[model samples]
Target chain A: MDAVAAEWWKLRSVRSTYWTLSAAAAVFVFVLLLAFQMAHIWDGLSVERRADFTLRPLQELGGWAAALCLAVLGVLSVTSEYRSGMIRTTLTVVPRRGRVLAAKAAVVGTVALVAGEAVSIGSFLGTRLVVGDRPFPDQGASIAHDLPDFAIVGASVAVFALLGMSLGVLLRSTAGALVSVVFLWHVLPLLVFQLPEPWNERVGSVMPGALPGQIAGRSADSSIYGDLLPPGAAAAVMLAYALVPLMLAGFALSRRDA
Target chain B: MCGGPSRTTVDRMIEVRELTKRYGATTAVDRLSFTVRPGTVTGFLGPNGAGKTTSMRILLGLDAATSGEALVNGGGYAALRRPMREVGALLDAGAVHGGRRAFDHLGWLARSNGIGARRVAEVLEQVGLAGVARKRVGGFSLGMRQRLGIAAALLGDPGVLMFDEPVNGLDPDGVRWIRELMRSLAADGRTVLVSSHLMTEMELTADRLIIIGRGRLIADTSVRELADRFRRGVLVRTPRPAALTAVLAAAGGSVESMPGGALTVTGMDVAVIGDRAAARGIPLYEVTPHSASLEEAYMELTAGSTEFGAVAS
Candidate 1:
């Protein structure tokens, strides 16, 4: 508990934490403007063309963009310590390396989770309010019905945060860990999308961005992701994305000298 | 500044025994052993790359030893639940995040050891950093960072303290402040181990010295012992050199004639030589006791052990 408090104090004391979270929150404003623009364009489109326009992408944009921001937050939390050589002081104070990493993961993970939920749900609601009564093809679902999916989307942000911290601990370099995170968050999914048929959908089904929809039991027909896995399997994979990397990071931290 | 009494009854000692550390093929610390006791400042002296930092790192559990034990208070540092309360260390003053405020930097460290925030402010005031407590460390000079580091070390009021090259970039006033602080800490019955490459610094600050070279212990003795070990004889000058030499020799002092009609007399102190000369009615010009300086003694001890020696032109 002391370690957790210390880690929380350390995270909150730094300016980078606020900077990254504010960047994550900026996605909300961007989504609202995009929603306003989409509503403006919806009025000009003929009824037939209106059936094709969907707000799903703008709704998911908040959580997706925040994943990158919060992940950067996660990366800096550990890598900054390494870069400044403060890791030795940290280890000296709390010699149980596992506890230190766990405390850090706990603190970073919780902040990302809360921010993720806010941005994800906030974007969804804000966009819906702006495009009120438009009744687009994909807007038929009630707020209560789509709320679970947005919640899962928020949870995915925490997963990305843990993954970023793990990479930071393993690489101990901000640039290296951020490159790896960006690869996982944006680049690899795009590359996976280009793979040959059944394989493309099969691999895309497990991508971090794709997991939220799958876990929420939503069909991925209009999206780049696939809907192959059952909800349980998708949820398990999401948990693995957060846990597996953290376990590896813990192992590496304990075995290596600070 | 002294705080409350230490929480533990454990004898405050830093014992490193047969400790060895290796980085791939390079040996950093090799079977090194030393014990630091309370109530005195023990200077961990070594030339650069002589494994002084490496040994301290292993002791602090920041690095693992290849084989051996570095016990603090008769146990491994890792086993201490609140290590900061038992052993405070300032390994590198620059190992701080530039973005953190001076108060917050020490604040988090204090929180880690379950120390109260009041102690943080007290230590900041003790180290004379209270005015800049809210300032970002990025704008601080090297000396300020050093004082901040010392404040962090004092936060928990630990029984044992270790500092590495703490005076590297300090002004003369800061140097004197650290010297007095170290002496006062030792006087308070706390074990203090200060590492430095300068024998002159240690000569004034350290009661006992542990000199290492090439990751090996060169000399583990007190300042007085080291000075006595390197003592040269007394030098005497007189117009009647032959008379003085005969008088000193009669008094069982071995006298050698110097080039300028002077004599180097061993086995007798200046007082004995002066008395013998006065007894013989021989006028004495000068009688001075000579001993090797601690800096020269340190150089001779670590002559070939310097890792990055340059070839003479």
Candidate 2:
């Protein structure tokens, strides 16, 4: 419990925490504006072009940017200490290194959950506000869609934040961890899509790029791009990305000298 | 070892036995053994790269020992229920986030140890940083950072305190302040181990000195004893050198002629030599006594063990 409080204090005391969270929230609002602008332009397009306009993925876009922000926040949680040489002080205060990591994980995960839910839900509601009145061709397919997708966006972000924690702990360098997260989340999927035929579908589906559709429990309306894991399977896979690295980080942290 | 409050009493002592730490093939610390008892500041003296910091890190549980144990109180530092409340260490003053305010840095450390916020304020005030508590640490000077580090160490009011070069990069006033702080902490019956590569820093402060060289213990004795053991001899200069030398030799004082016509005499006090010289009717020009300092002793002790030495061509 003391560890938790200390971690909380550590997370909130830094300027980067507020800066990154605010930037993520700003991105959410900007993406909402962009989504609404696209929705407004849907009426002027021809039938073929109109069919291509899908608003569901627009809600997920804001979450994507927010995940990037949270990932940076998570990486900084540990890497900042290393950069500042605060790890020695921290470890000195709490000799059980594992407990310190656990507390950091909890704090980052909690902040990510709260901030993620707020930004994602706000994006969804804002999109609804702009596009709700003007009905598209195939609207209102399921009434239950809004809340679940909203919740999923928040969960996906929180998971990414946890993944950042593990990477930060493992790398112990800010630029190194941040680059690794970028490679895993963005660059890996781009390379995966370049693979030949069904292999692209097979690999890209499990990558973080397919997370939005997998987490939303449905494919995007624009294109049937690849073979995606089922919702439960996708959730498990996403959870693995966070949990596996976290476990490894905890083990290394306990065994390795500070 | 038996465990309980009785064990706790024993645990309050910092004991490092056969502690060895090796990095790859290079042994940083080899079979180092020592105990820091309460009520006095034990100066951990050594030249640079003498394994002083490595041993202290092991004691703080920041680094794992390859073989042997470093215990605070009676158990390992990790096994302590409230480590900060039992042992406080200022290993590196730079181990603080610059973006955070000074108060927040110590405040978080305080919270980690379950110490009250009021204690944080008290320590900041104690370290003379209370006025700048809200200021960002990025703007703080190195001396200020040191004070903040000391404040953090004192937050828990621990029984055992360890400082690695606590006086480094400090002004004369700051150095005196830390000296006084260490003395007072020891006076309160708390165990204190302060490490410094500079022997002069420890000479005035430490009661007992643990001098190491090349990761090996050289001497563990009182500060005064070290000075006595390494005393160079009294140097005497006289206008009537031959007569003075003859009288000093007759009086059982070994004398060696130094450059520029001064005689270095040992095994006799300056007063006795003066009395004898007066009795012999020898004209005394200059009589100066040279006492070997802790710095000289330390240099002599670690002369061969220095990792890097300037070669005189």
Candidate 3:
């Protein structure tokens, strides 16, 4: 419990946390502006032209900006200690290395979950207010509805943050961890589609990088996702990505020298 | 609470027995064994790459030992219910994030041991960092960083303390301050172990010394004893050195003529040599016992054990 408090204090004491969160808010506002503009011009558009308006405000704002910033947040929690040599001090104080990792994961995971939910709910409500009481086509989903999907978006952000922390422990270098996270999330999604037949579809459904879209109800064409899992099952798969690596990291940390 | 002082008494000692650490084929610390008892400052002396850091790491449970035990207060470091209350260490002062304030840097460490935040403020003042308590550590000079590290170490007010070359980048005043701090900590009955590669630094601060070379123990004795062991012949300066040399050699003392009309007389004491020279009617300018400095003694003791001394071709 003392270790948890220490991790909490450590996470908030640095400027990078505030900077990254600010950047996340800035990106969320950009997405909000685009959603508000689309709601204002809904009357002038035709049925075929309106099909292109597929922005799920909750996912678009929280998924892209929050995932990227929270990844940095989680990765820096461990990597910064390694880079500064504070890991020696930390391990000396809390010699059970697994406890150290657990505290960090809890803190970063909580912060990511809370911040993600805030921005995603904010984006959803802002769009709801803009498109208020309008008799529109089927494209505009009511903000008062779809609460479960919004919760999934927030949970996905937390999972991504945990994944980043696990990578930080495995790699133990800031540049290497961040690069691996970016490659796994951004680059792997684009390349997975090139595989042939059932293999692509089978791999795509479980890909953690693409699960954010699934959580947001923006599942890509059947060719990209193959056969999409239900939202709850998709969340569990996304969670496995964070949990499996976290277990490996725990085993390695206790055995390896700092 | 800031000025309150309590000298707690506890069995604060470090014991390492047959401790060996090997990376693949090369052994970093080879069968090393030693004890650091309370109420004295034990200087852990070794050259660079001599496994001092590795041994300390293993002792603190930062690294696992290949064999043997390193126990503090009768148990492993990780097993202590309140480790910060039992041991405090300043291994690397620079291992702090520069973006953090001095207060927060010590605050987290204090929190880890269930120490109160008031103690954090007390330690900040104790290390003379109260002025820069709100400043970022990144902008601090190396001296300030060392002080902050020391503050963190003292946060829990542990019974046992260890510092690895705590004087590395300190100025002259800072050096004096640390020497005093080590002595005071020991005076309070705490087991203080400080490691340094420079024998001169250890000579001024340590009450007992444990010298190692090439990951092996060379000597575990006091500073005074080491200097005495390395003390050689008596240096005698005289007019007509040939007469003194003959008298000294005739008196069963081996004498070697030096360049400045002096003789290095061995196998005899200064009193006996002075009397022999006086009996011979030889005029003596000076007679002085040649005792080795800590630096010279350290060199002579570890000469064979130095891992990377420059080879003169």
Candidate 4:
């Protein structure tokens, strides 16, 4: 518990944490602007053209952008220690390497989860306000009905944050961890999307980015994701994304010399 | 000296038994064993790559030993809950995040061991960094960083403290400050282990010396004992050198003639030599016992064990 408090203090004392969260909040602003543009375009369009317009992508954009920002936050939480050679001091004070990593994971994970929910839910409401009562194709569901999916979207940000921290622990280099995170977060999904036929959908269903929507029982037909798994299996996969890497990282941290 | 309550009910000792660490084929620490007890400063001296840092790392539980135990207070460091409360260490002064303020750097460390925020301010003030408490550490000089590291070590008021090259980048005043601080910590009944390659620095700061070369213990003795082991006899200067030399030789003392009417007398005490000169009615100019410097003794002890030696031109 003391270790957790120390890790929390470490996370908040740095300027990078505020900078990354600000970047995540910037996504909320961008989503609102895009909503205004969408509303303007909707006003000028005929009813036939307006039937095709949807705000679902813009609503999901805030969470997606936040995932990247919080992931960087998670990466910096561990990698910054490694970069400054402060890991030795940390290990010296705590002595238990596993507990140190667990403490950091707990702190970074909570921050990411909170930031994720705020941005995702804020984007949904902000876009709704800007495009009030427009009745887009995907806006048919009531706000209460759509809230759970954004919550799941927010949860996915925590998963990405944990994955980023795991990569930081394993790689121990900011550039290397950030690059690996980007590859897993963005590049791997795009590459899997290009695969042929059944394999593309089969592999895409398990990708980190796709599991959130799948777990929320949303259709992935228009997106670059696959909708093969049921919500239960998708939730299990999302949990795996957050846990498996952390376990591997913990094992590595315990066995390797600091 | 910020010696809070005495937490010395424990053994208050650092022990290494047959401790060996190997990096692939290279053995960083080879069957090394030593013990540092409280109430004295023990200098851990060695050349570069002689495993001083590696051994310290093992003792601190930052590195795993291949086969041996480095125990503090009769247990492994990793097993200690709230280790900082029992053991404090400053391995590398520069191993701090530049983004953190001086206060926050110590703040998080103090928090790790359940120490209070007030202790952080106290330590910063103790290390003379109170003015820079709110300043970022990135802009600190190397001397300030050393002070910050010391403040962190002293945060928990641990009974056992270890410092690796603590005065590396300090100016003359900073160097003297560290020397005095180390002595005071030891005087406060703390087990202080300070590592350095410079024999002069250790000679001034340490009471006991554990000299290692190539990861092997070469000499483990007190500073006075080492100086005595390398004693160079006594130098006797007199106006009648021939008369004094004969009298010393006759009195079972070997005398070697030196430049300009001086005699190097061995196998005889300064008191005996002075008495012999008086008995012979020979006036003596000077009679002084001489011992080799600790620097020379360290060089001779670690002569061939240096891992990186340049050939003489």
Q: Residue B284 of model 3: what lDDT?
A: 80
- Global lDDT scores for all candidate models: 0.92, 0.85, 0.83, 0.92
Better of 1 and 4 by DockQ: 1
Docking class of 3: high
Q: Per-model TM-score of chain A alone?
A: 0.98, 0.92, 0.89, 0.99
lDDT of 3: 0.83
Per-model tally of clashing residue pairs: 0, 3, 0, 0
Model 4, B1-313: lDDT tens digits are: 4344655444678999999999999888899999999999999998888889999999999999999999998889989998888888999988988988998899899999999999998988889999999999999999999999999999888889999999998999999999999999999989999999999999999999999988889988999999999988899999899999889999999999988878999899999999999998999989999888999999999899888754110
Clashing pairs in 4: none
Residue clash pairs of candidate 3: none
lDDT of 3 by residue, A1-258 (tens): 999999999999999999878977886787677766777787678877777655453335655568778888989998999899999999999988899999999999999998877766666666566666654453265554665566666677778789889999998999999998888777776677777876787778777756755655555673345437766677677878889989988988888899
What is the C-alpha local distance difference test score of candidate 4?
0.92
Error of 1 at B114 (Å): 1.0
After TM-score superposition, the amount by which residue A227's alpha carbon in candidate 2 deviates from its true location, in angstroms, is 3.9
Model 3 chain A worst lDDT run, 10 consecutive residues: A53-62
What range of 10 consecutive residues in model 2 chain A has the weakest lDDT sum? A219-228
